[model samples]
Target: MSSALAQTLIVMPAFNEEDAVAGVVAEVRAALRGVHVLVVNDGSRDDTVGEARRAGAAVVDLPFNLGVGGAMRTGFKYARAHGFRYVVQVDSDGQHDPAGVPKILDALQTHDVAIGARFAGEGDYTVRGPRKWAMKVLAVVIGRIAGTRLTDTTSGFRGAGPRAIEIFAEHYPAEYLGDTIESLVLAARAGCTIQQVPVTMRERAGGTPSHAPVKAAVYLGRAAIALVIALWRPPLTLQPEAGTTP
Candidate 1:
């Protein structure tokens, strides 16, 4: 195992994905060598905990369904407490490809945060209607805020280096859409450099999808609200962790 792999942790946030969690964990383990895989079971009523453990992933069970942001915050805290230098967010439903993780981690060498972008000319992933328009607007808006061009600002397949790991471990927002949208604003405001790499997204191996085509319009409104909330917040005062360059 390489030194970088040794210091990295893959944080999978699972919510009622008992059927797919184990397979996703196994795929991630197969793709990334010598990296710790921690699955945060977000109050799953099913056997997500047992499935993850059987798949060789360490599990952290939440008391209730705190959403992705809350579950991710727990993952960040685990990464921080356990002395991991990097944390990559992977979905438990198997949409995110594990093979793309190393590209994200490589970007984190210089950037404080790295996103696995879907619309960067490397994948067949496509969205339409209000959700698509909302995503484009968000990319432009948040891209300007971060002083960099971003093709997919709302991508969940992302990684945080040491500096961002320290900040997110304490300040990651738990609101709706906060994990992807608000969290970027928070990291950028906290003086974290953000970047993205092209990655292909796959269909979910099992379980029901979270978003439906019928909810695209609602998603547009909520996305706009989330962006506003992110921008309205005051800048975070962040200091670099000891032994890590800012």
Candidate 2:
């Protein structure tokens, strides 16, 4: 069926993940009911769209690959337009656990945005060598800017409430890994309360990670650049979110 009206929507952004997308979709469907699943097929030159569709998810095909940030924005646009009060983003690579999906959404009850922090509470996700150091640096920088303590600032498993849906749908960042820090900054600046819930990250089910080998260096460079942009961004007077005054 097409985009059905639902209270909560799960958005999975995918690319060249024919093998992984179907399983991820299945797990999500089994873990959560009454929530529509939409997979943004980022111009995959594979069977990602077909597999996702076959596994019972509505699929949206992009003309070209626009990275995770772009795919996620597409999902947010749908959520805002379709009257979804809650939106959860799940990774197609399967690093994000289906069990943690509910935790993120549950945390959104009291907070404007809920992040499944892989290093929060009882997590053990690893960031190796220089990557670990970079993550720590980003944690301090982003946490300071967002005015909240953050762990696993790069984790993508997150849930957003209505106002967050509105803000990101209209003004999402297009930076690499902006899905983490930039999105949080946008929400926090918009007066959204962001909170991190403990969650575990697993190894990717299939395909190589987009940020592998030399791409890791690129991730670091772009994160550094995006950090500067977030720092310079002035907070805007956002509309009321979380039932609080703006």
Candidate 3:
């Protein structure tokens, strides 16, 4: 195992993703040799846990259904408790190519948060209507807060280094849209440096897309509220754990 791979954890928050989760986990393990992969089976009604286990991934099954944010909190806490120096969040639906994980992990060496950006000149992923507009606005706003340029602020393919991992394990948000937008705002407010790495995206191997065209307007409004709530809250502070190095 490479030293970097040994210290890093790949977290996949899966919910009813039995059809795709195993393949995604296998791809991650194969692409990043010897890196630990954890699947937070968020109360999946299907065979998510069994499939992930068969694919050589450690499984943490939640008691009940929690959205992506809640599942990720479990992941971050697991990483913190187990002394993982880095945590990368990858989608279980296979849209996030595992081949890009190493690039984000490499970026984590310099920045606290590394976002695998599909809109950053690498992928053909596109959105229309209010959703696209909301994304552009969010990129502009969150980018300023982090003191960097970001084209895909809503990207789920991201890695957090030791500092970010410590903070997130304690205060990760669990509300709707909190996993992506609010999480970025929270991290930036807490003084974590953020950077975007260009990455290619693929069609999901199974399951339906969360957002449909009919919900784009609603998504725009909800995204604005999520960002506002994140910023209105006071800055989050991290208390160092005894005898632990972040």
The predicted structure with the larger TM-score, 1 or 3, is 1
Best of the candidates, lDDT: 1
Give Cα-based local distance difference scores for all models: 0.93, 0.82, 0.89
Better by lDDT, candidate 2 or 1: 1
Candidate 2 lDDT for residue 159: 88
**Residue 46 C-alpha lDDT in model 3:** 91
Better of 1 and 2 by TM-score: 1
Q: Give the C-alpha miss distance for residue 143 in model 1, angstroms.
A: 0.2
**How many residue pairs clash in each candidate at the backbone level?**
0, 0, 0
Off by over 4 Å in 1: none
Candidate 3 accuracy as lDDT: 0.89
What is candidate 1's lDDT per residue for 165-208, written digit by digit as tens? 88899999999899999999999998999999999999888877
lDDT per residue, candidate 2, 1-246, as tens digits?
112224789999999999899999998888776678999999899999999999999989999999899999999999888879888899898988878877777777777888888787665777676677778888887787678898778888888887788888877776776778788877787788888899888989986678766655566667888777876788766677555542
Model 2 regions more than 4 Å off: 1-6, 217-219, 241-246
**lDDT score for candidate 2 against the true structure:** 0.82
